[model samples]
Target: MCQLLGLNCATPTDASFSFTGFCQRGGATDHHADGWGIAFFEGRGLRLFVDHQCAAESRMAEFLRSYPLKSRNIIAHVRKATIGDVRLENAHPFSRELWGRHWVFAHNGDLKDYQPRLHSQFQPVGTTDSERAFCWLMQELAKSHAGLPSVEELTLTLRELLPQVRRFGSINFLLSNGDALWAHCSTKLHYLVRQHPFTQATLMDQDWTVNFAELNQPGDRAAVIVTTPLTRNEQWTAFEPDELKVFVDGLPVEVA
Candidate 1:
């Protein structure tokens, strides 16, 4: 299995603090060390970085930890290489263009004997089941809507489409289109929101703490979603099995 991390904020915010602790799981702390990648959405443009090297030792991951790149939406993945070879193309947080917007996706679980008929525009460049599933979702979305649908509409389509994929195996994943982030739980996942009157939090994988209240303003809000709780002290809510939720402006919004 792989590890997933996502951030959605009311305003542009840097992920350096969370990422620093997350990168350690790629090799130093846990054993998901095949490869890792991340994507940050800035307006319509995306900053994507992928490497075949382990995140804990990769220079690119270290650079990201030092650089405070601000983004409204971000997705990251650390691969453990269950289905594909350790290569750059297998690195996750994969991106593709759809309806004039960039869509990013990352998966944390493995699927067995899962292969969908992708007879459309969207196609996978990697051999991993995660990428294949992403392409199939994109293909289906494109077929269901003439243009980019609203977040609510997209959520509905995803909810309808995901069951077919989940039948194969665990399909925990994160998806974003710069507007909102959608997270689905087939096995394990957790999330938490940080808002006004923030407090100090310590990382579970690393001996690092950050006082978010010292840096953030009253209006700032952020929602972090991960495969597991990143901070030891913060209260994280676990997602129910087969649950799919959407986050906008740092809060979960109901859609059907």
Candidate 2:
């Protein structure tokens, strides 16, 4: 299995802190050393980066450590190559245009014998089941709605679609379209929110600490969703088995 990391915030925030720990699984701390990718949402646009090298050795990953690209929504992944070759085209956090906005997706689990009938509107550029699933999802959404659907309506549609995909294998994923972030878990996932009374946080993978109280205002809030806790101090909540959650403006508003 691979590892996933995501963030949704009320204000633009850099993910260097959380990513420090998340990257460790790609090589240094764990054995998920196949490929890695990350995406940042800015307004209606998105910035994405991916590398075929292990996160610990990838120069792209090194740049990410210092690149303070702030964004309200972010999605990232480190692959262990359950399918497809360890190449850049097969990296996660794939992006495609939908509803006039960029939709980004990343998957952490493997799918077995998962081939879905898809339309030609969007096709997979890579051979990985992860990318194919993403294309299938976008294609389905496009066929389901003539125009952008309301959040409530779209959520209902997604709830129905996800189960069919999960039938193949583990289906943990993070998806975002600049407007909101959606996360689903078939096996393992966890999340946490930091709000007003922000406290200091220390990373578990590195010797670093930050006092959020000193950097954030009383109204500032940020939410982190990951496969595991990134910090040693802050409390993190684990997602229930086979659960799905949606985060809007950094807080989980819908959970199922």
Q: What CA RMSD would you report for each candidate?
A: 0.6, 1.2
TM-score for every candidate vs. truth?
0.99, 0.97
Model 2: residues with Cα > 4 Å off, grouped in runs:
none
Residues 1-256, candidate 2: write the lDDT tens digits: 7999999999998888888788988999889899999999999989999988999788889889888999999999999998899888998989999879899999988899988887667888889999989999999889889888876677778888988898899889999999888988889999999988889999888888999989888767888999988998888999987788888888998633
- Full-model lDDT for every candidate: 0.95, 0.89
Q: 169-213 in candidate 1: lDDT tens per residue?
A: 999999999999999999999999999889999999889999999
lDDT of 1 at 89: 93
Model 1, residue 236: distance off in Å is 0.2
- On lDDT, the leading prediction is 1
